[model samples]
Target: MISEKDFIAKSSTVTIDNGSFQWSAPSNIALVKYWGKRENTNSSNAISSEQIPANPSVSFTLNHCKTITKLAFAKKQDQSSFSFDLLFEGQPKEEFKPKIQKFLERIAVYCPYLKEYHFTIATENTFPHSSGIASSASGMAALAMNIMSLEKALYPEMTEDFFYQKASFLARLGSGSACRSVKGSVVVWGNNTSINGSSDLFGVEFPNTIHANFKNYQDTILLVDKGEKVVSSTVGHNLMHNHPFAEQRFEQAHQNLSKLKKVLENGDLQQFIQIVESEALTLHAMMMTSLPYFILMKPNTLEIINKIWKFRNETQTPVCFTLDAGANVHVLYPENVSETVLQFIQAELVGYCQNGNYICDQIGEGAINLSV
Candidate 1:
């Protein structure tokens, strides 16, 4: 655990040379989604910040769908202000500058070097941005890892877990789900009795011994729409504040999380499918029930979902579909049935995808430090 003093600015005597660092972090799909949050400063488990969640969430980290970010730090002659040049896909993204700047300011307390040096960051995503894929999760997680890489270079004594946990904490401040992206296979965020070492501050790897079937579970993302959503995820999360069913939904998520833990451990794919699909639907349901109701899923999204159900029922294939607040559908199945599933996707689901675009991704071993 990092102490409060670690977040304080250091004396001028402490310094590190300019360096370049790169990291590729995966995007995570929450099975038991984290939709609502509340301030918990009075509680003992409360983090230093006010953005911690009210309940825990579990997720599966994807392998191929990720963001690669390179941070080139340079000692600036002018230390009076934070300086950085941001680029996305080899082009300057002026609109994204404000958000990136705000994230740097928020994390500057812990990573004091951020203010001391100018950071030139170049980021690229494997999947399209603003689609169903969690670009924020991958993007923020990659940036957090880059920050931690610089810190570790300056302080070589930092342990591996400390670096990762701190990165996860920092990522959460940028995007809540990004915390879970730091851990691979399965990770749980938010404090819960079902998971040991789990906290509201940052996510922890799923403690239970996961079955082999789940270890290599596949998630083929069927992209129904490549365009941006009408309502941003930030807006969707905010609607939960006064949502009529917020309390009950939170309670239901907790219950599903508890049950899913057992399913994960026992390889109960049938029950797992039920819970995963329900959670995906419930996530959309929450958005629809909000004050200004809106729908993100398109007609093709439903068609693919129905096709998946039909194929699964006819073949008894342990396959299911989940969504990520967008028009895309995530076709989940075990690797053993990958042949049949991939064929099904090509034959039926491909027609529904936008421009015949879809991503073939699976559970990966967390983020990669490409800097090394």
Candidate 2:
């Protein structure tokens, strides 16, 4: 079997050689938010991912921890049969076998040449696995980007966009927003057109340019209630559609999208905070609008929000909070103030709640390939 030593070259930009490939994916933060989908194929695929900053979506794909993959093929029987084996950090993880199997099956249709041999793929996440940060998007992007590099190496005639498009679609199958994560700082998807919810409206259309410019902003996530998985981003999205406030929330989200884009273009931190906070409030509001509805905030979650608000009131800081379907509140504070903000939150959380833990985070660098 081919090994890392003899397989491929590595770099931040995409690369490939022989039948092997390695690449990276950057985690995306939705500025305008991409919630409530027109399609409900899966949880990650339920919504589009948008940008929230005014820095042209500058994400880092650092040289730190990252997922790398290599592909190889072996002849099985007389028919050139195929099977995938995965090694995580050196040891094998069977959990990814199914994900790999299905990924290979889907890719086969696009790259018929893939059926010619068996592929051995390896992957790893830079962050802790199963974290609530929707790590799958970037992880899948890394996987798909690596595979696309393999395809490009195997077929040099292919265009980069062609490879990326294939990867984007495959990434979508794995995680919806991931498709957009394939490129652009501020990517937008789903109800991309101004259809006004009319029947005449065409299907989804993602723009080719950066829709916003998010600056260097770090997200500090509190693990207050990282327990049993809350409703899937998919199920929650569907509930938003069928719920009575579906249309109204959509309208509000559309408006928020416009406002966020404007804030990004203008680079107004106060306006940025205004739009981000409003969108966060709207996301939670839609959740409560669902039947058999519930809220994900814990006592600590409220305390965090309260303290942030109080601190902001006292210091006139631009810190803001956004929640998904969990009790973990993602505090979006500017990078320049990350240290102070993180220290303040951690100290307060430890002092007031005494139970919740705060993990210091940065405007995570985008995806990157690793060597050694």
Candidate 3:
């Protein structure tokens, strides 16, 4: 629930005398499938003849987030500043340090002006650490926005949108989805492009209130096992290139996006469930088709899916499940049914999902502007 204006206030207050700034940001989830790609990791269309299916899967993000990146400078003889640290869940992640270093280099490139200022970034998650949620996306987006806000305070020549674009672009360097959180509510990440120069790797605002206003959407994440990190999406995509179903799957995802769009437009619960189930299977299908046949789903994954199916059959309720390149399963339902939904999951689906935790959140607001 970190307001955009509040984030900006922090950055604007920093100065050579003060020499430090602190800021925080929130993360978001994709509603329609951002599955396949065209050029430069842009989200592609589903493969159906109509380009999308009867419904587009909807995703809602919550205000729950990570925060407070403090950037300060250790002026090297008043010229060069050196050293940095990146903390996830508060322990020094030396592994991500080099990546942080690269980030510093890139940021300096954007505003060669900020080259003089050294930085100390301290970020933590209010939400679960790495329970299949992309804390970094939310984290970096906040940092990027704050940095730009700082620059504006230090240099009024920069436009307000300057920092947002800079931060949005910079977030891409950290994680692709991070780009989406740059703007909140019904944002389409990666190329809301047209035949003209209308879109690129950025957020696109949705106009309809129906897709933007639905309040019952709930996603309950079940962490199956937070063990070995899954292959990075970059590596996974490379594998996808070699995958037999890669091309076809891309097509299917495009169609699914269309169907998902329809569902959002019409709020068709049944269609939403069907398309989500298929999209999840299709996403994993690409991995299964890889040369090594990496099956990303687990027994618990099936257990959840099965119960969902059984629940639907027994009670004729509309509930669905989806997977994203890991053992974790994201269960979808309306907000009002969360209690009953989670109850059934705990009783019937809990056995399959041992050694994991559950987190509940619904769709949330679009990116906000901090008035620092």
Candidate 4:
């Protein structure tokens, strides 16, 4: 049981030299979405419980859709505050700095070395902007990994387990889903009674044996609308505070996770598709029923989903769709049906995509240190 205080750094007289590190971290698609966060009762100590999820969520770590970040650090004379510059795709991204600055502030206590050096962070995503994939998850995870690399340089004795665990912990403070992006083909976040070693503070790889049918599952992302979402995930999460069905939705996530555990071990494609699709729809249903309701799905999103349903029913192909907090859809299926499912997507579903644009991705083994 790792507590928040355990993440805080102890006073050290270690001298740090300047170095650079590059890391690539993937974005994750949550089968069981983490829609809201647990409420913070202690206002003075809010940062400690900041990104804790309202319910446990599990996801598949993506391969092609990721963020590759290069972090260069140098010793600075002024140790008064943190210093850093951010670049996206070789250009200064001023708009992204504030978010990064806030994240640094949140984790400053955990990684105290941040204040001792100036950082130059350059990052770029594999997917295009407005692709409906959340970059924050990959971006933060990459940055956290680089920061951990720096910490490892300072303290040479850090174990690999502690290194990744602390990196996930720091990433969680940046974005809730970012923790899952740190590692694996499948990861579980938030504490659950059924899962051993699952923690609300960070993500853990699924402990049980996953059947061969689930290995290397495919996720073809259909870009329905290449435009900004009407509601941001942060705003949507906040809405759950006063939501009428908040408790029920949270409970449903827990129950679904338990059921999905069995489905994963037994290779039940039918039950897998059922639980996944239902969870996706239930996520949006919670939004629609909220106080200030808003629908993130577009008309073409529905068309694509209908096509998937029709094709799945007629062909008995194990294809299904899940959504993020946007109009785009993630078409998920097993690797065995790749050729048939992809052909179906091209013939039937591609027309609904924005300019016939979609990304073909699969399950991945999490972030990697490119510098190594």
Query: What would the TM-score be for candidate 2 when compared with the true structure?
Result: 0.75
Task: Give per-model TM-scores.
Answer: 0.94, 0.75, 0.79, 0.98
**Which predicted model would earn the best TM-score?**
4
Ranking by TM-score: 4, 1, 3, 2
Higher-lDDT candidate among 1 and 4?
Answer: 4
Clashes of each: 0, 19, 38, 0
Give Cα-based local distance difference scores for all models: 0.86, 0.56, 0.59, 0.91
Report per-prediction Cα RMSD to one decimal: 2.2, 8.5, 7.1, 1.3
Span of 10 residues, lowest total lDDT, candidate 1:
1-10
Q: What is the lDDT of residue 230 in candidate 3?
A: 60
TM-score of 1: 0.94
TM-score-best of 3 and 4: 4
Candidate 1 lDDT over residue span 298-322, tens digit each:
9999998899899988999999988
Measured by TM-score, how close is model 3 to the native structure? 0.79
Position 18, candidate 1: lDDT: 86
- In candidate 2, stretches whose alpha carbon ends up further than 4 angstroms from where it belongs are 1-18, 39-82, 104-108, 191-214, 350-356, 369-372
- Worst 10-residue lDDT window, candidate 4: 39-48
Best by lDDT: 4
lDDT-best of 3 and 4:
4
